[model samples]
Target: MEVKSSPYYYSLALLFILNLIGTDSLWASPYFQSGDSIESRREVIEFDESLIEAYQADEAYNYFKNVREESAWEKFKHWLSLQWNRFLEWLLSGISEGNFWNYMALVLKILLILGLGLLIAWLFNKYYVVSQKSPPADQSELNLSEDERLIQQKDLSTLIEEAESEGNYRLASRYLFLNILKHLKDYNFIEYQFQKTNTDYKSEITQQDIRSDFSYASRFYEFVWYGDFKLGVTDFKAAKMRFENLIRNIHNSKTHG
Candidate 1:
């Protein structure tokens, strides 16, 4: 019987052979010239000699010599020049000895691999691990315009009342202060975006000279909102005063400016 080969098998074998050849070519090629090789070797020898000389020099002797010297701009400039020369020498040595293109190619390959890996991870997370689970259609869409101010105010009042009644004074203070800030922003007394951390907002308003008032309120609010710290009646009163003062100042500034 005549020998026969499957076309699919042959094609696969050819592809595998081609890949092997390409890989070999990529790795085995001499990446530097002979002249460059000699120059690099000579430079390395010089560097080694210089390093040995420096190590043999007495550091204590050099420090003593410099101690008696007058501090002058010329001395500083000379020292800087010496440092610059050393830097340039090392830079040139590295370039002459290094496979620059190969290094760049390696970095690019690593980045490409990392990007692909991240893309795959994201796809897995989105599709397999935490697949989309839609909320009820009616509740999915938030009505931002429908009595939003009134709704926010009511929520704010409820939180305060609940905290006060339950003796959760910390919670009451935090909610009250945040509601004041929210109202100030809403009323254009202050230009601020919601969901920003207090630290970030504090930095923005630093030049406005409201740091003390704003920071006090923010710190108290943070303790109540995120920490297990208990708030006393005194602390609550102080926070309330700061919040009110902050709002008043912001509104006054807006009106004046």
Candidate 2:
């Protein structure tokens, strides 16, 4: 061969450097370059073709689309069609006979369809109607209205004594709450009005401690009396104690102030 100088030597040196870097890069042909060209390499996506494939894949839509397809629904439809044709033929034959028996058969077929429809409706009502209906309201809680019926009497002290003597703690709790309201009214902290709700009373009281004490007594009275919850001796005593403590505290504050 001819003696090659600079060109041959430079080519050999370049190849040696590439080999040193690693032989892995040799596999990166134009065909397997990277995933960036994969989308471009794919066949053109036609909307019509994709839509057809999707429709074919949908079993439910296909079931109704191609009526001749062999499925359970088709089997049922085929049987029904066969029965209906047979019935028509029989009916025609019976009509040709010109007798009462043919009319009876037609009437019976109509009745059967109506009965089946009624049965389906009744089954739906039996299972679904109850869940659709709203439940009844609980009668255990009293309604705290704006009516003055809550603080009914002026002389609650006498009523309280009478209720205590009779051992009617529920009645006594009610009477005690009335007495608390009376005290508040006398103190000019709140005006006794039939139109004023419990919320009104709380709003009228500027003192935080008094409002808290009054709310407790008021709720207790409602739960016992209006709510129809029978208060036992121990329950009544606790309620009475709370009311008396609050009343005593209020009395002392007024006296000392």
Candidate 3:
């Protein structure tokens, strides 16, 4: 029997076709949605049954499940995707009644607020909280007697001379540079700022030019201390000149002003 179709009947048929497509998209077994939590043991059992049916119908699961040596990162990503799918499902279900553009706008606003909050937190931690800590206790106390200071200077000079005599040029350079830094700290020319207990001394020298000079000296000291490359006689001579110049500058700055 042939039936004539009205416009209402045609529209109804179109809606039914679209609904079938949507159901098929939602029910597809291969691509799991992000953030899908296992809500119940019953849900898990149902999922296993569905998986068994899918394996029987399609041959892909057998091959994938047989892969034994998956990396830790791969497993983590898989679990993360599953959780994401569960979250997405909850979010979509709640927002389904709203207009699509309104939901999208809400999501963007939430993201913007979250980003701004994180940025503010990071700035506060970096500039305000971290900067307020005191310098090392030993560095703050400048109560050394003149004789003690002279003895320290003498010990440092002897160490430098011994290293040079032994032809351990690298050690000699490092000893000389570190001695200068120690002297600077003792004289209150620079404050020892502790990042950790082990690595103390951040330069709080006020003058930019002096800070730059100290940084250059420190870099060269580190290079000689840690690097395997040999320094030539000319390089040693240059280092000595720079060291003497630095001492003179510090003394001059103290006396003239």
lDDT of 1 by residue, 67-129 (tens): 466579878999999999985564445445578875675566668779999999988865544
User: lDDT of each model, Cα atoms only?
Assistant: 0.63, 0.72, 0.63
Better of 1 and 3 by TM-score: 3
In candidate 1, which residue pairs get closer than 3 Å at backbone N, Cα or C atoms, i.e. clash?
none
**Candidate 1, residue 71: lDDT:** 73
**Lowest-sum lDDT 10-residue window in model 2:** 134-143
> Where is model 3 poorest over a 10-residue stretch in terms of lDDT?
135-144
For 13-115, candidate 2 gives per-residue lDDT tens digits of 9999989666666556566666657677679755798888888998867756644668998889999999999978865667676789887887787788799
- Superposition error at 62 for model 1 (Å): 24
* TM-score, ranked from best to worst: 2, 3, 1
lDDT of 2 at 215: 90
Estimate the TM-score for candidate 1: 0.36
TM-score of each: 0.36, 0.40, 0.37
